[model samples]
Target: MGLGSYLIYIALLMIVPLWAQSKVKNTYKKYAKKATSSFMTGAQVARQILDDNGLYHVKIEETRGMLSDHYDPRKKVVRLSRDNYHGHSMAASAIAAHEVGHAIQDEQAYAFLRFRHSLFPIASLGDKMSIFLIIAGFILGASGLIMAGIVFMGFAVLFQLVTLPVEFDASNRAMAQLVSSGVIRNNEERDTKKVLNAAALTYVAAAMVAVAELIRFVLMFVASDD
Candidate 1:
């Protein structure tokens, strides 16, 4: 790709995530206002699901920040944002269930989630070191260093790719749990799906950006060789 094309690609990398973030936020905001028919809080829903799945040891804690919910596999804890933890809304129920889905995955040793976890250390190191190594390689005119950097970048890209399946499976589990547990009524399932799907888009956008950047880096490296 030419310089102009590269510029456009970079712009897209920036735009796609922003757009996905906006979509999730807007969708969450819309559904957050609409209470579930069950009138159950996010924490309550999560607790019920965890207990039903025999995850009594896994704990749910209230966390600060907007949409900061996550399951810490190391700690065996599901942390929910304050809004979701306390709010009795469709968004809350959906998000809470999604995080608990991860906990269930942990208990079951879900393959993709296990693979992703195993890759996390290398991916974290790659994320931290790749840019600096690549820049240093260019400065020193060292193709070896550049290739090493690209390899590290490749790991990060793989991590993102693996993450896609892990997230989608979690969302699928979340919806099933929601239905089975009666946390969300049949009529409310559609909007709950909207919330989970919007959240899933953010992961899709992240993986796309990572793959695109890796391709751009490889192209730059090959051009330098020429």
Candidate 2:
């Protein structure tokens, strides 16, 4: 049963992300061609929302990448991909607003976002080291190293867990801002939400995969003991 469960989790780890990415890509592709009623570029929407939220210091910068939009809390800047920064489509508006939502969270000192930020350094290190440590532990039959690896992996899993609420809240803030700032109309709200929801699923999928990996590691540790 344990082996079967582990294999199932392994399958999920492989399948979930691919499914999530497909949803995001499909949803984005569908909406990217659908122009917003306001016809405002993503930069314009981001600028308007930021200014309205009294985040005047938050700068909007264009970046090169697909789906690389993010808010740099340290730099106090909202970076949008070239497509989002210049495009005037539902996908552009939704993505821009979602990133600006992170800016708003930063300004408000959102608890989850702050917590996630705090966890980033350790989580990053753990993410990089945990797999190697686990593999080495298994190879050398060192239970202590296996336990240490599990602890490190735990931090990464915790980070992923905390990231969920932060992402969901950002999307919520994005929708509210989009509506309140008149960036998207009532008729367009559904489609905008579809875009954001699809994006959120990617995060959810990632968190699930992280959790499953942690469980798999724990199971491995137990099996090693026997």
Candidate 3:
């Protein structure tokens, strides 16, 4: 397909997830406040989970953007968004704990997470190289350039596949950690699950779409060669 058509397709693929994300974020904001009676700030809950899980080495830091919470495996840090960092709501607590889950995974050397980390460097390289390869390949219409583009896209897809289990396991950890730590009561587990599941859906959807796009690109190049 032409670049114009590709752009349109990408735009369309992006819109549904964006809309879904917005709706889920709103839903979490509405109900997450009512999750548990802990009344602990996000940072405090993060501390509790770290201490409880014996992950004293993992640091909690504030990051820019709303809902940008994540665990950076390279740095062994849990970066929480400003809102999630300091907010005194169930939403904040749950998110903080979720990041802590990654720390625990790192400590335990969880198989999937370790696999994801192993792919990081190549994935980073692939992320940067993919666009350049694709743009250059289109300009030259060279088979070698097209193949390079395909390889780069394949690396990215591999990263996404590895990331799937890491993220889902972290969400699972978050819920279990809360109960084990007494940060959240058993009765309120469902609320925590809802918010985390909603967040997880975004990642799962993105990975699926990435795979689809990569397959499309490969097929296009192959057909052109034929």
Candidate 4:
């Protein structure tokens, strides 16, 4: 609860992001080189899945990040990152299919993804509010402000929890569709699984960092009060 304890927590917090980033980058690179099945570009694969599911309105567009692909429920579009957008590898097919899984979720009104997307605005606001509330609480020496900060951070934690099911479902759908539709052969299943699993770990890593930071903030308030 003292300065040394807080410093250690902060240092640990810093490590997850770097480690997660490195793992994702390495996984993508490793699969990119080893991929042998080259049936379609990532974009083509995504579009194929979308059309196959009759989601004609859900457009697949390029976004500007390495492995930053995602589905925008609001825009009803799939955004593919640079590597998978044009890359023709098992990794690309998997990435593209994963985003499409989200689109499928939208069509079927999957509970978890819907909940997560619905919480986006509240979670975004709470994330900023938590910081301000915590700092103001510390400066004013008020337990009430710290309590409010905790509440605000609670939404951030909840968002992370809500994301797990959504992410896992997408990966499941991606792998299933790939296997069933003959997009990825049985021999290539492991490659896709490797990419998706590595990507999922990054989400888990982010959630852990948020939870750790929240604990550190709570410790600060408890220490100050003592």
Q: Could you say which candidate leads in TM-score?
A: 1
TM-score of 4: 0.92
Scored by CA lDDT, what does every candidate get?
0.95, 0.93, 0.82, 0.86
Q: Model 1 scores what on Cα lDDT? A: 0.95
Name the lDDT of candidate 3.
0.82
Q: For model 4, what is the alpha-carbon lDDT of residue 160?
A: 91
Per-prediction TM-score, please? 0.98, 0.97, 0.88, 0.92
lDDT of 1 at 109: 98
Model 1 CA lDDT for position 223: 94
Rank the models by TM-score, top first.
1, 2, 4, 3
In the range 5-52, model 3's lDDT, one tens digit per residue, is 788667757875796688678867876557367777788899889988
Expressed as tens digits, the lDDT of each residue in 39-66 for candidate 2 is 9999999999999988999999999889
Steric collisions counted per model: 0, 0, 0, 0
RMSD in angstroms, candidate 1? 0.9
| Per-residue lDDT of 200 in model 3 | 78
Q: Is candidate 2 or candidate 4 better by TM-score?
A: 2
Please tell me which model should have the higher TM-score, number 1 or number 3. 1
